[model samples]
Structure formats: structure tokens, C-alpha cells
Target: MSEYDKVRVGRLVLKGEKLKTKKRKHKKQGRDEEGTTVRDEDASAHGGWWKTVRIEEITGSIGIEFGNQTYVKALDNGLFTLGAPHSEGEGPAPEEILTAIKVNDTKIALKSGYGKYLRVGPDGVVTGRSDAVGAMEQWEPVFQDGKLALLGCNGCFMSVAQDDDSVVAVSKTAGKDEIMQIRSSTARENENVKELPAEEQGSLAQVEENYVRKFQKFQDKKLRINTQSRSGLQKAREEGNLHEILLDRRSKMKSDRYCK
Candidate 1:
């Protein structure tokens, strides 16, 4: 049996030297009810983990926290087990952190620190030995009634084993023990914001027609757009005069009511 399989969950504790806690000086002061001044600490500085409520938000590094402060930690042998309990405001350890990739809209794949993908073996043990993600490597995070549970490809819910605390997928239905939190760092800003298309960014002929329809006063209600060679317009766009050029085109067509 592997070291992870023989290890008991209760006996596990954070290994290696303790991480030094970063201290910050609060510049702002606040008055308490007793009229005493106190330093106002930023809440964001204390914790970096944010609960991932949506599957689409499960990108980048993540920590699977369950049963108090315990997390699912990746072992060197490509196996996973319940890690040591962490204090409040403490982030997960390096081995406890895993890279999460959104496989699709409903499925995701977890890559351990060992650079292996996590998948359920035939024995239902959650192991990270696969080099590539397949159907068995894809996992679905089920969220219901404000509870989160991970559903493996084998149609079993992932949970910590009671005997050894090894991560496994065996239960067909998710219960209290299956409820877990997937947390990510708060450094991701605008991660879900997609770039707008050229037409949507008002850089295409279709966008010109849309502007004309919104602001143009046509007697026949027909949309009119400049169909001539757009080489000059493209140059104007490069020179930061595209809007002026578009307005000039509208004026020549006598279609813009705002044009004087």
C-alpha cells in the first residue's frame, strides 16, 4: 500500500517549516464604541481564498477544503489525501493547491502539483496519475441548496474516507460529508470578461449601420451605409479619427439628423 493509503487522516499535520505570517501596518484608524482609536485592517489582506460559486469561475489554482480546515492535498506518488488542518485566515499549503481547468460548461479537470491529472481509479480511489484529461478525468461540481459537491465521472460523489482519510469517489449520492468548498485566490480580476468582437466595438460596417439606425432620420426608414472603399476609413481609424470619418460619411449621405 502507498504511504497515502496507510496514513490516517487524524495523524496528519502540516509538514515542514511553518510559513512566516506577513504583517501589514494599518494607516487608517477607526473609533470604537468606547471612543478608543483602533487600527482598521483591510479584510482582503487577511484572506486570499474566495469560495468558487460557479463552475466557470473554477480556473487557475484552487484548494478543495473539507471537514473543518482540512484540504485535499496532492502527494508525491500521484495520490491524494486529507491534509492537515489550517488555521483561520491561513491559505492552503503548496502541496494542497491544485490547478483547476474548466473542461466544459459543466465539467472541470484538476491537475495536481505533480503535473498529473486527478481521476478516479477502478477501486474508487482518487489518484492523480493520468497525463491527460479523459472522460474519467473530467469532474462535475454539483451545487444545490447552497451546498457544493464534486461528482466524478464514475457517477459517484467524492468524499474523504473514514478509515484512512484518502480522497475517494464512492457514494452515488452526495451527503453532508460530500459538501466541500473550492476556493481560489482573489487576485483574478475580470477573468470572465471576454473581448468584444470588431462589430461590437464599433469597428465594422455593421456597427456603422447600427449607429445610423439609432441616430439617422430616414424618410423611407431604409438604412444607408458607406459602401465605398474603406481604405481611407481604415487609415482614419488607425489615426484615431474613425468616428469623425464615419460622421462625415453620414453627412454626405444626408442621413444623419445630428449633422449640421
Candidate 2:
């Protein structure tokens, strides 16, 4: 397909990525407020600890099955590969990546990984690979299968580690107010493709009509050639030069032309 055909699909993915990045940054800052940040004391950077901040993040691996024995390779950029790698890990290439992510006829497979400190859902979506919580440490909240685990703040008359997962729902946590509650991958989009705009639709229809005319003209020429061959065969039969086997062969040749 031409680059123009990809205009709509490409735009949607690009927009989604932008939103994902913004959400990630905001979450990082929120986690930071609850956790402590450590900066290296040494001026020269050769042997010093890297700046550390706590964050809650979620991650998953996707395995797409294209056809028999075909799968995609994961990349740091979150894209996948199509064909077998020329040399392991070198990459199956950009063209292959494009083919793997094609909008139609491709099936996706998802594998969820280890949970993170922050939970996106009540106990549902686990955030992975985040360091936003700092070094306070954490214990997994035992979320009863169907119970709502609200991350409320404060205690009986109380005091506790302010960085716990439960703080997410508390009204007073420094950054809890800004956490955007969003449903991941839950958008309901129209599965049926939208009809092209009238002007665009008309242009495509015109292109189709031209293709059909060209195909029809080719068929007409083939038919005319067969008609002349049949006439020649008939004349050959009537003149005393007729041979029964030759007549049968001519008929077979006409039949075989289409097959060829």
C-alpha cells in the first residue's frame, strides 16, 4: 500500500504513544513525592551511584503469530519483527516490522509480566518495572478476589509508612489528587471501517472503473483471436484436405489456450 493508505492508522498510534508518554511522566513525579531521591556526592562521575527515584510501572510482552512458525522479535522501541533474523538479534528489519503490524489479518498474543509497586486497577492491572516508590520497600496487598482495595490514607489515630500502595486512594497524599484514573486498552472503536469521504470515494471508484475497462478489453481481444482460429479450422475441414485427427487437435488447442 502507498504511504497515503497508512495516514489514518499511523495517526492514531502516534497520538496514543504521546498520551502514554505524558501519563508515564506524571506517574513518575507522583511516585517521587512519596519516595526519596539520592544524588551522588562525588563531583567526578566515574564511580558514583546513579540518581534513584521510586516509580510504579507496568509492562508486558507481545508475541504475534503471523502464520506457520512465524513470530515477531521484541525491540526496545516496542515494535516487533516479521521474518527470521539474518543473524540472531540483529533485527529482521524495518520492512518486516511493518508487515507484522499491518492492520488486517494479523493476530496478536500478549503475555503479562511481573507486577510493579503501583497498581493501575483496584487489584487488576499491575504496574511493572517502576522505581518511583524509592527504598521504603513494599509488601503485596492481598486483594481478595473481588473486593475493592482502596488506597486510602491515614490510620486509626494513626501513623504508617506514607509510601504504601494504599496511599494512592487517600485524598491527602501529595500527588494522589493528580493521578488520572484511566482504563487501559479499553476504548471501544468502530470495528467496521468508515466510508471514505464522498469526494475521495468517487476518485477510488473512478480508478476501479479504469482497471475494469482495461481487463475487459484484454478479454475481448482473447475472444476475437479464438473466433478467427475456429473459422480457420472449419475451412481446413471442408476442403478435401480434412484430417480427422488434425480437427480434434485443433479443438484441443483452443481448449488448452485458456489453460496455458
Candidate 3:
């Protein structure tokens, strides 16, 4: 039900605001043959008219389902992954304005709101460019139960993995278990517990060992106290001294109640 859900492909969106342009004083402009001889007046002025070049769906559901919030933002620098946008009529959010175009039969490409292509590095890092065309920008849509999980590119699934810093990472993997619901684009990592590195795992093991030692010490102390009480009772029984046993029990009770 958010405003971004209404956005579709080929729709022209307004940016911030409009601005007036000054007349060119000099006209001796040199450019390539295919380049423009004169800049378009409409393009020069800021009328906030940004056309929706592409619409890439992060999830398979048309409605706001589990993963419907996932969106890729096309910024001036590059294509950044984003979630559902709240902005309405004013302007299109970067993530709400992307063109998911089919590059070929089995591949697809996500172009930014301003025509930049989303690309991924071999190391699973993602970036966007205005003028680069490579296989790194292409992805194969992975389906689960006839629903779209996400696009798979290179050797990884084009998914978002958030790190400890809360920054969303452009990661590629088969999937992530950090998140239970598929609604979150970034992996919801549990910050309270951090999975230690291989070298640091021994520290966790050492902690466990310390707990075991403390528990064993408590058990040994409890056994020794019980044995001492049994010996006291046996001594009282041998002498058939009921009064002494009762006195001893009362003294022990008082000592236990007052002891630190």
C-alpha cells in the first residue's frame, strides 16, 4: 500500500524542483558527430521530469508480500540496493526507479533510474556504472515455489547481506539463514552474538570450560557437606543422643541463615 508500489515502468517522475536556465553567451561548441550539437532546453532546466527507465522487482509477489520491500536504487554514482520507499507524488526514491530489463533469453539487467547499469565484482561486491556493459551486470532470476528469490549472477545469488555496522552489503550467495522472514532485503544479523573467527573460536570453548569447572566445584562442595552431615548424624545415633543431634541441627540452621 506504499506509494512506491504504484510506480511502474515508462512513467515520468518529477525530481526535486524546477530551475530556470541562462542563455548561452558563447556558441562555438565542438563535439563528436553522434554527440548533440545543442543541449535540449528541457534537459537543461530542472523540471524534475525523471522518466522511469526500468522497474526491477525484488520479489515475485506483485503485492506487498514477504520480499516486496526489496528494491534497487539508481543513484547518480551507482546502483545501490534499497528497500520500499515512502515518498509519494513529490519525487521518486532512488530505489523505486529502476528498469529491470531482459538482456537476453535467460539473463536480465537492472538499469538505474538515470540509465546506469548495476554491476557486480568477482569478489561479490556490487557497483553501478553509466557506461560499462559486461556480464557482471547480468543476472539469472532464481525461482522458489514459482516465486522469485532474486537474481543470480557470477557465482553467487544477487542477495543483500548486512554486516555488523548496519550497512547493507551487495553480497552474492545461495541464501542466508540470518533472516527468518523474507521481507528484509538485508540480512538481519544478531548483533548480541558474534560468530567468532576460527582463531577466536577457542575463546568460546574456554568460556564453556570455565563454566564446567565452576559447576564441578559446586557439586564437590555439596557432596562434602552432605557427607559431613551424615557423619554427624551417625555419631549422634551411636550414642543414642537425640538432644545433641537436635541441637546440632539447630546450630547449623542458624549458621546457614547468618553466614554470608
Candidate 4:
């Protein structure tokens, strides 16, 4: 008898002959594809609260405030729109917050809540569909006088459509509608960290010794430093000629091998 017709009338199902069924993949609740929890607390940790007043402070996680009480928000469809206004004191919603990565001194890239890099399309519509940053994903924040605007890589200024509140980059020149503010949670005190040149970093005596150690040939293993007035050194440092003045001092001491 054919194997298909040989089934016993009773419960004689063969071992290992059961139907192979696929395990159902239940979608995770409140979690993105990357397994990150989509909660307001996670957005807050990414600097979603404070308002950034300066352009230099526009790094890390930030929000673009387009209009009064309205912020540029990312949508599930990978597009941006001006979100509904919130209370006067409340900050942007979780979807309105984005990660701003400084690509260079003049350009920055933004990543939306969906983990996609934002870019301007040929139609000037802003979309966040790229998985990684590219040339088109870069944006320049132009600050002039007391106003700020975002310039897209397409040479258009980002502006909100008055009809639909959609975020688009259509105008080459930034107008009143294009002005926007980027807010962040960075402390104001941390913005201006004092930086000094290597030669003038420490106390005056230490500054002198640092140069001496760097240039001194020390044939007899004895350090020789210029004990003359450090006023000229301080002046040179202020005038941005500290290196030349330090080299001259080492040359006068007959210590630096390269001074000759």
C-alpha cells in the first residue's frame, strides 16, 4: 500500500510526523526595533529639558523650537512637522527631541527618535530615513545679529509651512519664518572653558621652565633659564607671538640647538 494510504484507522500517527509550525513573533510593547524602551524618561536623559540660547551649545541631544511654544517634531513616517503648542513653561515632547552630532566646526547632523539621520530631499521636504550621516545629512546653523536659522545641505533654509505646519527647506534666504532656536541641556557654565597654550599654561615661573626644558641643550646637564623681566613674555603671549619670543629667549641663552 502507498505510504499515504497506509495510515491506521486508530491513533497511529507516526513519531516526528507532526506539522511544523512557525513560532509567532509577538511585537514588543513600548520598545523600538533596536530594543530601546520608548519612554519619556529616556528622552529626558538625552537633554530634552533645558533651552539652549547659544549656537555653540547646540550639541548632543537637542530640540528645534520653530515657533512660540511649537517645536519641530519627528513623525513615524520619517517626516518632520511643527508640533502642537505646549504650555508656556513646558519643554518639547519626546518625539520633538533629536540627537545633534557636530560633524565639524561649521556643520552638524541630526538623528531623529526613529534612529534615522535627517536629510533634505530634492523636493525640499525634510525626511529622516537615512541609517547613517552623509553629505546631505549635514546642516549649518547660521547665527547673525540676534537671529538664528538652519541651512540645509541643499542650500535652502529650513522653514515651517504656514499651511500645514510641515518642516521644509525651500528658501535659499532665511526670512522671518525661517528663524528658529535650538535648545539643549548643557550647563551654561561649561560653555567657555579657559584654554591656554602649552607654553603659558601654568604659573609664570613654570611657563619659563617649560620652555627652558624643551629647548635647553644642557651640555653640562644644568638648566639655564632667562631671569629677565617676564613682562615681555606676557606681552608676547597676549599678542600671539609667545612662540617666537620664547625661541628668541632660548637663542639668547645659547641653549636651544635649533635657535642658531
Candidate topping TM-score: 1
User: What are the lDDT scores of the predictions, listed in order?
Assistant: 0.82, 0.27, 0.42, 0.82
Give stretches of model 1 more than 4 Å off: 1-46, 186-260
lDDT of 2: 0.27
Q: Could you give candidate 3's per-residue lDDT for residues 26-112 as a string of tens digits? A: 764544333323232321221222211122333221111123223344445664544453332222344445455667666666565
- The lDDT, on a scale of 0 to 1, for candidate 1 is 0.82
Weakest ten-residue segment in model 2 by summed lDDT: 49-58
Task: Score candidate 3 by TM-score against the native.
Answer: 0.36
Ranking by TM-score: 1, 4, 3, 2
Off by over 4 Å in 3: 1-70, 84-95, 130-132, 164-173, 176-260
Pairs of residues clashing in candidate 4: none
Residue lDDT tens for model 2, 149-220: 223212111011234322122233223232221111111232233433222223333423332333324433
| Model 4 C-alpha lDDT per residue in residues 1-260, reported as the tens digit of each score | 89978876655568888866689999866434433222345235433465555556788778898767678999999999999887655778889989999898888999999999999999999999999988999999998887889999999999999899889999999999999878776555643544454655677678879878877888698899887888887778778887888788788898797877
Instruction: Give the lowest summed-lDDT range of ten residues in model 4.
Output: 34-43
* Residue 94, candidate 1: C-alpha displacement in angstroms: 0.2
Q: Per-residue CA lDDT of candidate 1, range 36-133, in tens?
A: 22222322322567777788778898989896667899999888999998777777899999999999999999999999999999999999999999
